[model samples]
Target: MDVKLTEEEKIKVLNSDDIYGIMQKILLRESKIDQNREHFWVIGLENNHRILFIELISLGTVNKTLAEPMEVFSFALQKRAVKIILCHNHPSGELRPSEGDKDITDKLIQVGIIVNTEVLDHLIISTKSYLSFADTGLLSELKKSTKYIPQYVLEERLKKQATEIANKKKTVEIAKEFKRNGVDNETIALSTGLSIEEVEKLRVRKR
Candidate 1:
């Protein structure tokens, strides 16, 4: 944990891949300390992806840990983290996500929305391998509320915005074609879904 970093020791995390690599090392180091029951860890990061802190949320039994959203988020909230990554160890060496794993991820994602913190991803760690919720499409299936949008949701919205812009450009072209064929501004508006003023501007351009 770079929590002890001085002002001169600023470590910038470039992206999710960077965090995943860092998390693997952190989990492996923690593994040496305890090889028994499961441990849930919460890692907080600033908007620029700088590490704020890493904390243990709960130490669970063989298969389960009671994790409340409030407890999971308490530290991140205190540190003013804009995003968080959830990491937990599986004693059984199974990389698969358990029911409890799924439950906490869902709960935390919703809690993040309410508190203005976004849950970027959840990682299931084992000594041999790791499973990423973002990689497996589970992160995409999380229930989102109107109150908050997670990073993955924001990426999706950006994609839609690009498509909408392309469609509007196509509509404008169609309107020009209509005008070229002697179509009225009212008719062009109806056919291309452009405003009457937009059609008039195109007509003036053609003239």
Candidate 2:
């Protein structure tokens, strides 16, 4: 059977990776840390045939222990994503937005605009359901006073900080800790928002 694809259908198929679904799966696996983790969902939206379905770009996670926008948006930019829908699972299952979540969304929306992308929605998802900041009119308020930061500038600052951290570690044990835990230089670069060179320097010091 020959199937004729509508333009909208074509786009959906083209971007059928289902990033949100993947995020849901990841969150389910991380149930142990559900109460303290934040997940970022970055997606791209293409306007074709007057329909907008999200294209999966990348995913990042921030624990209550480490919430960093640099780590989040870096993946988005790497994916060349044109839009994003940020989501985090609330282990407590409370469908309310926290102050910190609001603040981060505000900053991300601003950054998105500066980077020529759109922050379409921020969702707080639980096992049972979800909340959409855009649908609730919260995003409209945030769009009014968004502060823009260039991606390159953010990356440069993160690189310097990572380098500093690497410089301070003066033990083979710390380096081995990174390697034994399956934390290679590339993983360290991603986790710390550092450059590969900096992570390599740390590895070299260990040897």
Whole-model Cα lDDT of every candidate shown, in order: 0.76, 0.58
lDDT of 2 by residue, 1-207 (tens): 112324433343122233334445545655465435554444444433222332222233443323456655665566565666666666567869887778888887877766776777777776666787877889898876525456686688689999876665543445446756767777766665556877676543332
Error at 90, model 2, angstroms: 1.0
Off by over 4 Å in 2: 1-23, 31-36, 44-67, 146-207
Backbone clashes, each candidate: 0, 0
Where model 1 places Cα greater than 4 Å from the true spot, the runs are: 1-11, 14-17, 31-33, 144-207
Query: In model 1, which residue pairs have backbone atoms overlapping below 3 Å?
Result: none
lDDT of 2: 0.58
Q: What is the lDDT of residue 47 in candidate 2?
A: 38
Provide the TM-score for each candidate, comma-separated. 0.64, 0.50
- Predicted candidate 1 versus true structure: per-residue lDDT over 15-106, tens digit per residue: 55665566556556655546567878888889987878877878777767677788878889888989988888787888889776787788
Best by lDDT: 1
